[model samples]
Target: MRPETGMSATGFPALVLFDLDGTLLDSAPDFVATIDVLRAQRGEAPIAADQLRPHVSRGARAMLAAAFPRLDQAAREALVPPFLAIYREQLARHGAPFEGVEALLAAIEGSGSRWGIVTNKPEALARALLPLLGWQARCAVLVGGDTLALRKPDPLPLLHAAQALGVAPGDCAYVGDDERDIIAARAAGMPSVVALWGYRPEHDDPATWQGDALVASAHALIDPAAWPRPR
Candidate 1:
């Protein structure tokens, strides 16, 4: 079903910021594949993709920890470079936007709202992947983890994105699949939505995150009613 479109009660958001991995994009497949490649090179059995999918959003270190639990912190850290190298070589090989994302983006644009991405992925990787997804020119602002001195859960990236869009934090909504996403949004004074469809650890509880709203799928987010509004 097509979402109802028009300015909301508080007016359309000046901007909508999204988390890339897990949120807007299903990138776990490529990440898991990269981990499996590493394991194969060591003559080790490949870890199940399902087992490593949840850690994809948490970044490479988390995936390495899951794939090689026996590895110490230093060992896991050492693997990051090679892991990312392999990941970069096959970044979008299996990555695709979640279902209904294109329609959701259309709805936002139809309302004259601008959208952008705010991700913890490295800037270069994020930039590289955007065009492959045909989103390079469409994104209003792109803020990666390394875009500033700090990343999510610190509010810098979100705030910076709002600033770049020339919108007040309160005039934007940030949607993400991780607790850090909500924390950063709340800290930046923006309404936040928890994307339940994104990568989430089995132990992680979205209920406890205190996000303004929760959406089960990209389709749900296309609805203006699903968006969090300033209180």
Candidate 2:
């Protein structure tokens, strides 16, 4: 394989896996706009993007809950459709790859290494977003929350992504912003990195997630040394 570029391969891992919503794509802007549109339609005060940003990485349900904290389960479910519609319409408008993501992906791919995504987003919506972000052709594979019978923190989705990419779970590394992401990677026997750049509620801490590594920025991920080589 080609030597890993963009950074010194002091301890490069075999395969690199990614989280979509927060780690790869900065999706909060689009999500916030959708919330504003929905709230305005309902004659309610619009929520700010920063208020909803952290939950965007958590998935649509979380964003909906954040936007309508007083709503019951039934009302929350009802709001999903409209929120999704507006989100789709503005999907590419403000959302984009996080800083250095394109370069990181390119460097990884150019190094003769393979990378893919494992996200809690639904397959249809995630698939739609990828193309808009120009990642549809770059990522080797994408495992959405609905891709299998279960999602993150269950290990199954990560395992499925590794299997589909012809790599062992132990050979892959997962990078994300939440505890569930680290938990799933650990359960699947895959190494993980906690992405500090992604959205996290004020009460959360990436250090507490207990990932193999903690990345301070998106650019750091391109450094092969960030991933300890397998023994």
Candidate 3:
């Protein structure tokens, strides 16, 4: 902690932006429930949650790809509409924030820093999650994948959030679980922290993502000094 600032040495970043699925909320159980229903309709047994969890961060398409490797492209594409319909019903039914997330969020706010979400989840779906996650009024901003012309890996969402908050892009710190998350943050001129506690396949290497900081859990993120300084 820095005595004069009464904060971490660098203080918390002015804005702390997080990705949805793998970073802040552990919504995989809901996704798993959605996908398993589709699997059941085809007389297929529900796929293992372990098999589907890591890929959830990549979104529905990736989850489908992992679940139905036996299905060709078109068949899986056809499952999307039904998949989403089922997902809407299952939202937050069995999902909640990852352990330690609430405390971490409180810590960020306690430091007088604003935090928000910038996620590739669709706007309606993401908005639906706010109350379920108890973040309906706490977040300063929420930018979903469809909120902008483009989403993660495009930098637009992150930049848009910063602009909406009247913060310079460099004053924000982005946290996420995917390579695309780090890419978007970089393009938006914000330093990024890799959520190692989030999802990824065994073969995917986040070390190659080149983020400014990497943390093991939401608990680790509670420490103000863990955040990177503005660029």
lDDT per model vs. reference: 0.88, 0.81, 0.88
State the lDDT of candidate 1 residue by residue for 1-231, as single tens digits.
222233345355668999999999999889878998999988999788889998888998899999999989999899999998999988789978999999988888877888999999999999999889998888999999998999998999998988876777887899999999999999999999999999989999999999999889999877777887753
lDDT of 1: 0.88
- Residues 96-215, candidate 3: write the lDDT tens digits: 898899998888888788889999998899999899878999999999988888988999999889888878888889999999999999999999999998999999898899999999
Candidate 3 lDDT score at position 108: 82
For model 1, the superposed segments whose C-alpha errors exceed 4 Å read 1-11
- Candidate 3 backbone clash number: 0
Q: State the weakest 10-residue window (summed lDDT) of model 3.
A: 1-10
Model 3, residue 142: C-alpha shift (Å) = 0.9
Using alpha carbons, what is the TM-score of model 3?
0.94
TM-score, prediction 2: 0.92
